[model samples]
Structure formats: C-alpha cells, structure tokens
Target: MRRSRAADPRGRAADRGSRTVTLTGLVAATALTASLTAACGGGTSTDTEGGNTDPKTLTYWATNQGASLEHDKKVLTPELKKFERQTGIKVKLEVIPWSDLLNRILAATTSGQGPDVLNIGNTWSASLQATGALLPFDDKTFAKIGGKDRFVPSALASTGTAGKDPAAVPLYSLAYGLYYNKARFDEAGIDEPPATWSELVAAGRKLTKGGKYGLAVEGANLAENSHHAFVFSQQHGGDFFDSEGKPTFTTAANVKAVKQYVDLLAGDKIAAPGNAEYAQNQSLKDFATGKAAMLLWQAADTTLKSHGMKPGDYGIAPVPVQSGAPGQGRNVNSMVAGINISVFKNSDNLDGALKFVKFMTSDTEQKHLNSTYGAIPPVKSAQDGGTFSTPAQKVLRETLATSAAPLPQVPDESKFETLVGTAMKELFADAAAGRQVTEKSVRDRLAKAQQQMQS
Candidate 1:
C-alpha cells in the first residue's frame, strides 16, 4: 500500500527546504500542566494545579500546517470533548514548529517526557521506530480507525512496517509536481504543459529568452535538489536504491537524468543560475514574482493563491516523462511526502495515545484536513474533497494519479540526500564553469557518493 519504491526516507519536504513553521500557541489550563509534567517526569519541575495528575487526560502534539490546522483543532476539540464526557477523559493538544520537531521528539523520547500522540515526517518513521518508542499498530488498534482500507494504500504504506506491525497510521499524504505560471506560458505562446522530457526542455528553452527564468528549482538543499533529480532519473529509468537499501545512483539513467537536471540551468540556460543557492521560498518567490515560468512544487494550489495570484494565472502538471521506460506514462517519480504519527513508548497513556491516533487519522479527519490545508489525503475517499480553490488542484491530482514512487525510506536517508545534493551542486557548478558534462565527470562525482555509502 505504501508504494515501496517511493517510500523515500530522505524525500519529505522539510528536509527539502520547503516550508518553515512559525509556532503560535499557548494553554490556559494550569491544572492540566501540572498533571502532564507530573505524569511525564525528567524535566525542570514546576508547580501547577492538576499537573497531568489525572490519568484520564490525553496530550497531543501536532506539527505546524497552515492556519487551517487551527481550524481542525477547533473541530477536533469538540469531538474530543464529547469523547471525554462519555469516557471521563481529558484531551490536551499542542502545536509546534515543524523545523525542529524531529530533534524535539528525539530529545523528549530520550528523556521520557513528551506528548502521548505526535505528528512526524513519514520518512522518519523508521528512525523513530528504531528508538523503540512507538506503539505497534495491532488488529485492535487498526479497528479503532475504521480499518486501514479507508486510507490510500500508498499513504498508509509509508506509516507502518512492510511485514510487521505498523508503527504509525498514515495521517496525510503529499506528492511533488511541476507548477507553471500561466501568464508566462501565455506570453511565450505556449498552449499546453509539457508531457515529455523532450517537450519540457524545448518549452524551457523557448521560455528562457529575456531575464525571466524557465524553471525555478532548489539546487542546494538536499531533499529539493535530490527529489527533482530523482524525478528525472526515474523517468530515464534510474533507480537510486536497490531492494537491500543500498545506493545505486550511478546507473545510466541516473547519469542522463543528472545531466538534464544540470542542463536546465547551465546548458539549456532555461533556469536561473541563482537556483543552486535557493530553497523552496526562493523558488516559489521566483515563480510568484514572474521571474521564473515554472517550478517543481509540492502540496495543493492554496499557497499560490495566497500569494495573490489568481487561479487562472497558473497551471499544474505531472513531471514530464522520458521517451521510453518501464512505466512511460508514469515514468517520472514525484516525491512521496507527508508527516507520520508516533507515540512515545514511555508514555503512561498508551491507550489514550492510541485512541487519539485513530481519531486524527479517521476517514472523516483526513477529508477535513485535505479540504482545510489542500494536503493530499491518505484516504482515497477523502481525496475527493474540493481541490484547492483552483482548477490547478484537479491537474495536480491527475498528475499524482500516476503516484510517482515515494522517496527512499532507509534509516540513513537524510545522509544520502545530502550526498545527492552535493553531486548535483558540483555538476551544475562544473557545467556553469565550462566543463564538459561527460560520463567521466558524473562518474567521478558519483564515485564519491558510492564511497560515502560504503562508509
């Protein structure tokens, strides 16, 4: 169900430099604080009434999404209230910035003091599971969430173990795709989005005249750079890792894709030179400001519209495919993305924690989340909600229908992405400096990656 090949442990957006979380939250319940601290020790002691003293209270930690998540909290709070009223339990929720979330979780896990239920990057599931701090999803737990069948198989796949019990339920799912500026396309006389790698190159070149860039891609950030390169590599028939979770980025397809990825900015001259130094914000700003005609982006169309761009001013499409490959129509690999839900093993409220997990990932909650934040719903049924306030959502959804594989799901994924990004940076830099993009140069760069993999 998780689309094994696409289960990239290094592929999620946070690592890719996509969005940053600016946290804004406060709780007015003193008694609740006391109960929580008392129940989960190992932190600076503080005195607050009812200090998590009650065993019936459940604490939840959610990563920052858009303001819509606050709305979700509002809806969920009432639902929790009803549950608590019936069961004589209390629910405490906290929202934290996504940037340092993993570090926070790791620290909390080590100290034995953290939320009972928490949201995490799906790719981090394996690493976190290694800590033995997560509760396995058994048959009883699965039933609490209306069965796993309600969610998209691919989304759920990323959340749990392939053969054993799952560590987490798929909360939401996302994929990457090409986002283009309609105004730029129209002005360039381009009528349709590119459908093949060849077309993409041609369109990019045509749109590159003038100071405007044809594409805006992040080249420095490991995840962003590697994901873009992965799409091209997969389209050309490259597989970055093997069944044993080993590095395999030096394949012929990878060589070709890497060349093309670099050429977009250096050889083809369709992308901005500054792209190598930019992250997600810079790329989005480039497209929004009309400095670039296209970019590979994740999530729904809400962010674009939020920038004051009209829906008709832009378009969405799947990453173009190579001429021939095993899955030509779906040759391109969009990074499988989304956060994972995990519970600390040391939590005293394991039962309450599991209940909250089931509630958050229920079919109903997924639909509302998808609708609220334009997040791709892990539940196939929930994915039917209204696309972002734009037709672009439909196009993006259609593109994702091919379901490009998730990124690598190895525990050492973060390190691998950095290696890929380093190779790309060197490749792009070499091309820009007038070096021949021969197989030798690529081989040399990849050799470094191979060496690192071995170490």
Candidate 2:
C-alpha cells in the first residue's frame, strides 16, 4: 500500500491507491508477473504447493509494507525470528511488489501453488473470494484466530461479500484523511481544516496563493483516482453497481461525483496543472515538501516523515463531505482501505498457516507491525492508546469507525476501479489542457466506461 500501496513509505508504505504492493514488495514474484495474462483464463489446476509436508515449516508471501523491499525484509526478519523462537515453525518469506502481486495471486489461484499465507488488498476480497482460492474464515475458522469479536466490525466488513464466509481477515486497517500543512494554513489565516465541501474550496483558495498549490491530487494514479471517485460517489449517494451487480457508472449522482472530484483541478484551479499525470507518490512528495498545502491520503504519516515533514508540520482531519459533517451512508468521505491476510485453500500446511495468521494478528504483533507502518491495527484491542493515539491516527480511526464505507463487494469492482479511474485520468488530462469539464463531458466519459463493462 504504497496494499497500504505503490512504492509509498512505510504506513500500509503508501495508500490503497498503491494497490497490491507494500501492503511495495519484490522476488519469485518476477515469475508470477510473467504469466498473469495466461492465468486469468486458465482452467483451475489440482496442483498445489504441497511440497513442504514438514509440520514445522510454512511459506509466506507478504506485500512490501515498508519504504522499500529491503526495508520490509529488515522490519519483518526480526518478527519472523521472534515467531520462530516461540514456535518451532519457520516461515520462508517472499516479498512481492504491488505491480505483480495480483498477477502472482491469480497465477497461484489458477495453478494452486500459492503460499500458505499471503496479504491481499481488502477491496479485492470479493473478487478473490469468487476464485475460491482463498480459505474462508467461517465461525470455526474465526475461533482459530481469537474469534470474530477480536477485530473491528468495520474492518471485518471488507473481508468478503455479504452473506458469505470472509475470504480473509483484516490485517492493517486504513482510511483516507485530509493531510494539511499547518504552517501554510496558519500563514493563510485559516483556523481549522475544512468541514464541508464549500469550506474546503474556500480554504483551498486561500492556500492557493503564491507558487505553492492548495491541494495535491494523484490524477493519473488509477487506484487513487478510483478511491476518490468512490468516496465522492458515496457522498453524492451513488453506487457503481446495482443490486444485480450491473455497472451503473453513469448515474446522475455518479456523474456529479466525478465532476466534483475532477473539478478540483478543472473548475476550482486549486491543484497544479501538472498533477494530471501523477501516478507515483509525486502528490505525496508535493505535500511533504511544502509544494502543496493539502493532500487526501491514506496512512501517510510515516511517508511524510520519510520526506522530512515531521508530525508537527501537518494536521490531519476527516475528508470533507458534500454538506454536513462526515457520517455513514451519504456523507461518506473515505473508503475502507487496508490490507487483508488470507491463507490459501490449497496450502499444504493449513494448520501451520492458521497458526501463523493467529500469531500475526496477535495483540502484540498487531501493535508492533502496524506501529512500524503507521497503520491502525484492525484488531480492536491492539489499539491501546500508544502509537495510534496521535492526531493523524485518531482522525483515521474515527473515520473508519464512523464514516468510511467498503467498496461494492462485486467481482467487477476491480474493473470499476480501472475503467472509471482511467476515464477520470483522461478528464484530468483534458482539464490540464484547459478543456471545459462540463456535465455532458463527464457523463460522456462515464457512459463510455460503463459501455466497456456492459459489452
């Protein structure tokens, strides 16, 4: 995630916007990347990674959850060492990159050679569940990992589709928050973070003076674009799919959502024109380096610190809503974002894998790992007024508990992220070129995207 996402620093090291990486990782993943296209349509194989019959040994695949592949290894080696000491079980770990994680998992699902346990993006729970590759956590399974009550209710919601066994368990809980430069706000005579959409635009205008921009947007980053699009659509009372799981990309409220988000650049002029092509952590860089006064990001504290912007340099607040304060249902400002850990159904070491999951989600490990990554631990009791008590974590925690909503638990959800996200990317490019991003233009783009799905 910069899984917490793309090449982001250690908090989830990026955002759900980063997709399947850190939450950024590398290695074996190279081979998996090569066969993703083929694996998608391949018939399921009875083959599995059943080589290691030794009861004490297990294999694990983890998304890069730190500043770099090496950083993740450095942080995890010690924990694995500790785990090895406690139980004679040894976990051979392979860190996979975000760009290749999904492909690899798909390949594994098709081939039945996936590791005993691996991390997945929470949003992908339903899609992966549809594959039947992941081990479902039923009531009995939950009992293996300290019971379902141990995790937060909100965090557990994204584990899979409703009325089914969860394909995974929440590992690191994340939610979007508006991160603002305090000095810039204070100098601009702004007192508090924006509460409503109107106030956000107004505050942005004040911070948009001089060479520095008011807000940083990851316009070309498909996942970031989709995450924001989803949140905005929710605030506008829209859904990407109907009850039958059909794409509803161009609904009236949806069109409004895309327009409002895109208008941050096209209509408002608060974000920089160059932001249209930012797929990498360039937006995060802008916020960290003082080039932008505000950023809407997930678990960005550690990443900002990596850029030398300390905790005191910025303030975190709930992402603004369309009208009143942030809340459930319509007024949702953040999507439930984070990583989920799951065991493979074909794992040779099922018992060992379950033990590993229990160990990883243990109260002690949750505090240790989430603290290092700057993510809020999904385990309810893991958060014990320590590292998570800070203002940033506080806001993210509150948002997840109250305002955040899960992405639609449909198999086409990933497609929705891609199509609408790409459409928004195109709209941002048009805006960068000074094109009028009107209602018709927005609807046209969405209609085309929806058509791509329906066809």
Candidate 3:
C-alpha cells in the first residue's frame, strides 16, 4: 500500500518507508494499555456523561499533503475556521509527518492520548480496526456524515474489514496507470500504447534501441515491487489472500505473474540492468529524464511536472493486461485506496470529532482538498462533478471506480508486505546479477515466503 512517496502527494516526509510491525509486540502493547486503562478508569464510557457532544475544542492530526506542514496548514486552516463558524467548535490542527504518524498513533492508542480525528492510509484500515481503538461508523453514526451509499463502492470497501463496520471512510482516492513518453513512442513508430503483455514486450523491444530502456521499474523499492506483483497476479486471476484472509502467494497464478514481472528484466530486457536499484522516485527520474520510454504509476501528473516533464510529453493509459487470460483480464489492477479519515474511540470530544470527519468528507471540502493536492475525490458526486479536469486524473478516476481494489485486508498486512516485498527485492537482485531466474526459483521463493507467514 505504501508504494512511492511521489504517488502520495501527502507529505510522508516522516515515514520511515516501512509499515512493518511485530504482531507479538503489538498484542503485548495493547494488552498492557488495556490493563493500565482499567486501573486508571480511563477507557471510553457508554453513559451519556461519557460522550462529550458539545466540546469547545477538537484536536486533529492531519497528514501533510502539501509541500510542507506550513502548506497544509494554509490549506486546512480556512476549512477549520469555516467549521468553527458553523459549529462553534475550534479545531487544534497538528500536521504529523508520515514517518512518525503510525508510531504516534500506536503510542496514542496505548496511552489513551490521541487526536479526536486523524487521516490514515486506507490500507491500514483493517489492521487498525482489529485494534478496536477506532470509533466504528455504524448506521446511526454514519447518517451524521452522509449515507453509506454516497461513497464510491471500491473506495468505501477499504474503510474496514468486510461484513463489519468500517473503522474509517474514504477521504481521497487514487489509482495505478501506465504513463508513456509520447515523443518516444512516435519516434519508435509505435502506433499505440501496448494493450497486452506480449504487445508490451514487442513495443519495448522497439523502444529499447536508443540508450533508453523501454520501461522504468522500481525494482529496489519493496513496496512498489509488491504492488506490481499484486497487479500482475490479479491479471492472472490470482489474489494475495484467500477469502478467509490466508496468504496465497505460492498459488500457480501468482507464480506465473511474478515470473512474467521478473522477465521484464531477466527475459524481455525492457528495463535497464540498474533498475534493480531504482525506487519509485528513481524510476520516475529515469522516465522524466528520458532514460526510459514508459512507466506505471498513480497520481503522477504533479510529480511528473515537478521533474520538468511537460503535459504534452506524456500520455496516460490503462495498465496492459494479459490478452490471452480469461475475460481478457478485465477489471484487474494494482489494488489501490488513498487516504481515509478516522476518529479515536477514546476521545472525549466524540461529537466534535464526528462532525469534523463529516465536514472533511463533504463535497465542498473533498473538492477543495483533493483539487489542491491533485488527487481524485472519494465521493461519487464530487467525482462526477468534473473535479478532475486533467486527462490523467480523469483516467485515474475511471480506474478507481471500475477496477481498483484494496490490498489484501488482514491484520498481518504489515507482515504480508515484508514477506512479499523482501522476496521481490531478492528476486530483482538475482535478475540484475544475471542469474537464471527459472519459474521454479520464483515459486520456491514464494513458497518460502508463505511458510514464514504461517510460522
């Protein structure tokens, strides 16, 4: 879920670039926190006196989605002021860097000291919900914000565990796309963007002649690699987990997908040899600087411009599929969800927190915030209102509504990331070193990763 920093326009400057957490440590910490809360009489109470409906002030921890904390403050302060004018409740906004947000949230969960409301990566919804530290939006509570039917189905599905109350609601949305250098394609005489796996390889071969490789890949970034694996696997009719949330990384469909992905470097030779060391940022650089003819990313318009690539220089298209696959690989993509909003269960100002959450997801605010950050709004009405004016953004909006899905929703999501991402890193290394990356090798590594998860 944590793929590229650039993909998330939010200021993740504080994120250590890893979401890995030890399940044992988390359980121990939660148990200790619960014990302390009971001893101190600090847990949330169900009585009328316990729920503070009319608080004078509310604390909000916002993820940095702009150039800096200052930038986000500039964008959000006016909105908070509007909320105060309308509700007589002042919001104390604290912009937390991505690096520190998760740890801070965990500590807050244990200490019963946290902001009334906050923004979280959508992928963390299920894991956080499992903690029971978040305020669940049931039918009565959901009406205060908006009807559940108001949100995009795919985006809304990511808010929590399926068939249960979601711990959060979608605030912003994003999706994966294939970006290409139009000029390079024209020069290579490639009439259209590749629409299938075989076509992609053929196009890459033609685009490979010039010092530039045909495709830029983030082989070194495990998160990015894991995402690519998910996309490829989905195209092959496979999923990372079963319906019961058990990991299925060693499935035949997944093995075929991973082998095809590794083949880009090991077999097709479309990506550069050094790409094994490239992170998302590095891969973007390669494409922006004309070192590669194509790249796959999400919410890349802003970053592409920042890197000096012009609007006319690139074109956005749906990710290529395996044409020979069943149903022509329709509706398959890298699982995606953007940022989501959540309220802490232990907050004294529950009323103010819920109101703020609603206000943030309201059509006006969704448009304002997503427009400033260049991301797609999560609300169906906002998306339909022509909020995304750019060709790329529009494409992403369609992709989210039609094809995108949340990553495997399991409490061990962080563990899934580690196992799959680490395996991908090693696989890329082998390919870069010119080792024979057979299908058996790929399957064996996946089998080992699956075993570690079980152990």
Q: Give the higher-lDDT candidate: 1 or 2.
A: 2
Q: List lDDT for all candidates, in order.
A: 0.61, 0.76, 0.72
Candidate 3 C-alpha error for residue 385, in Å: 3.4
Ranking by TM-score: 2, 3, 1
Which stretch of 10 consecutive residues in model 2 shows the poorest summed lDDT?
22-31
lDDT of 2 by residue, 237-282 (tens): 8888999889898999899999999999999989999999887567
State TM-scores per candidate: 0.80, 0.90, 0.86
Question: For candidate 1, which ten residues in a row score worst on lDDT?
Answer: 22-31
Single out the weakest 10-residue window by summed lDDT for candidate 3. Answer: 7-16
Clashes in each model (backbone N, CA, C under 3 Å)? 20, 20, 4
Give one digit per residue, the lDDT tens place, for model 1 in 1-455. Answer: 01111122222421123322111110111001212222242222233331233458777776554424464466456767766885676877776544445556655654556777777667656545544567667777778767867766666656644676777777656666677888888888999888776788889888887788888866654455666666777676676888887888788877777877777877787888778776434566677778888877665344555466665777777666676345463465576666667765556666566666666676676666656555666767666645533565565455455645656555545455556767887777676566777777887887787677566
Candidate achieving the largest TM-score: 2
RMSD of each: 7.3, 5.0, 4.1
The collision pairs in model 3 are: 11-64, 14-99, 15-98, 15-99
Better of 1 and 2 by TM-score: 2
After aligning candidate 3 to the native by TM-score, how far in Å is the CA of 422 from where it should be? 1.6
